[model samples]
Target: QGMVGGMKIPLVQRYEAGFRAGVAATNPNATVLVNYTGSFTDFALGKQVGQDLLLKNTDVLFAAAGVDGLGAIQAVKEAREAGKAVSVIGVDSDPSHLAPEAVLSAVVKHVDLVVYEAIREQRQGRFQGGNVSLGLKEGGMGLAPVRLDFPGKDEALRTVEALKARIISGELKVPTQPAPSGTAGANP
Candidate 1:
């Protein structure tokens, strides 16, 4: 797996942490390679990074670099067109529409819903000024519907739902930070 991020911000780090955890849980033998482009708007750099990762034989690429991620998605699309067994995971929204052939799914963040709730609360004299933690159970973050046609997509979706339930029930904890070096899901 390859993960390309816009920057080393807390949000992106959290995404990486969750991604690494997911890979570890699903395929313990898999390795993750990560890169930070520093700038969130550099499409060229994102594409270059994506291409480099693909050259390393990454089966899946995760793009969380804002607009820059579009370039990574392009690289994955091209690679897939060239008959490479590769796909990309989008972020922020369901980008499967952009490249349904190459995009496996997305880690969607319902920012609009959050903003709407905040405004509604403010208008109702119930505004709060603090960070709020929301996850699958709160309808804040979730995986987009997988659009790729694969052999075990149904089974995979079922497994994902089961894991989601465990996470919501606090039976499975998705790490918000990468583990220490040499540990499972640790950053390289």
Candidate 2:
């Protein structure tokens, strides 16, 4: 698998780091190649990077480069059309609608829930004046449905649910920073 990012910004870093952590947990022997386009809106650069990663023989690509991500998705779709067994994972909002066949799934942020919580807190006089971090435990974010059919789909979903449960229960902690290569579960 591989990941393409827009830049080395904090938001992109978080996404890349989180993805690496997940890959390490699920497939310890898997190799995760990463690249950055250095521009969030450069679709051409994203496509070039995506094609480069595909040449490395990645089965899946995670596109977390904002608008640039769409180009990565397009690359995957074109590859699929040529009989390549490749898929993409979108970030932020669902991109499955763009290319249902090439998109495997997406990472969805529950912004509505966040807004509702903030409003409810303000109404209850419990509003905090600082940043609030929420994850699976607080229903802040999650993976969208798998749009493409693949073998072991059921098993994969089951495993994902189990891992999510562990995360929510505090049994497993996901790091916000990238782990050193060859150190799967190391924090920091």
What TM-score would each prediction reach against the true structure? 0.93, 0.93
Q: How far does residue 20 in candidate 1 sit from its true spot (Å)?
A: 0.2
Show pairs that collide, candidate 2: none
- lDDT per residue as tens, model 2, 1-188: 88889988988888888888888778877778888899889888888899999999998999999877888999999999999999999998889999999999888899999999999999999998888877889889999998688999899889888988988999988888876654443431
Worst-scoring 10-residue span by lDDT in model 2: 179-188
Q: How many collisions between residues are there in candidate 2? A: 0
Off by over 4 Å in 2: 181-188
Show model 1 residue runs off by greater than 4 Å. Answer: 180-188
Q: On a 0 to 1 TM-score scale, where does candidate 1 land against the true structure?
A: 0.93
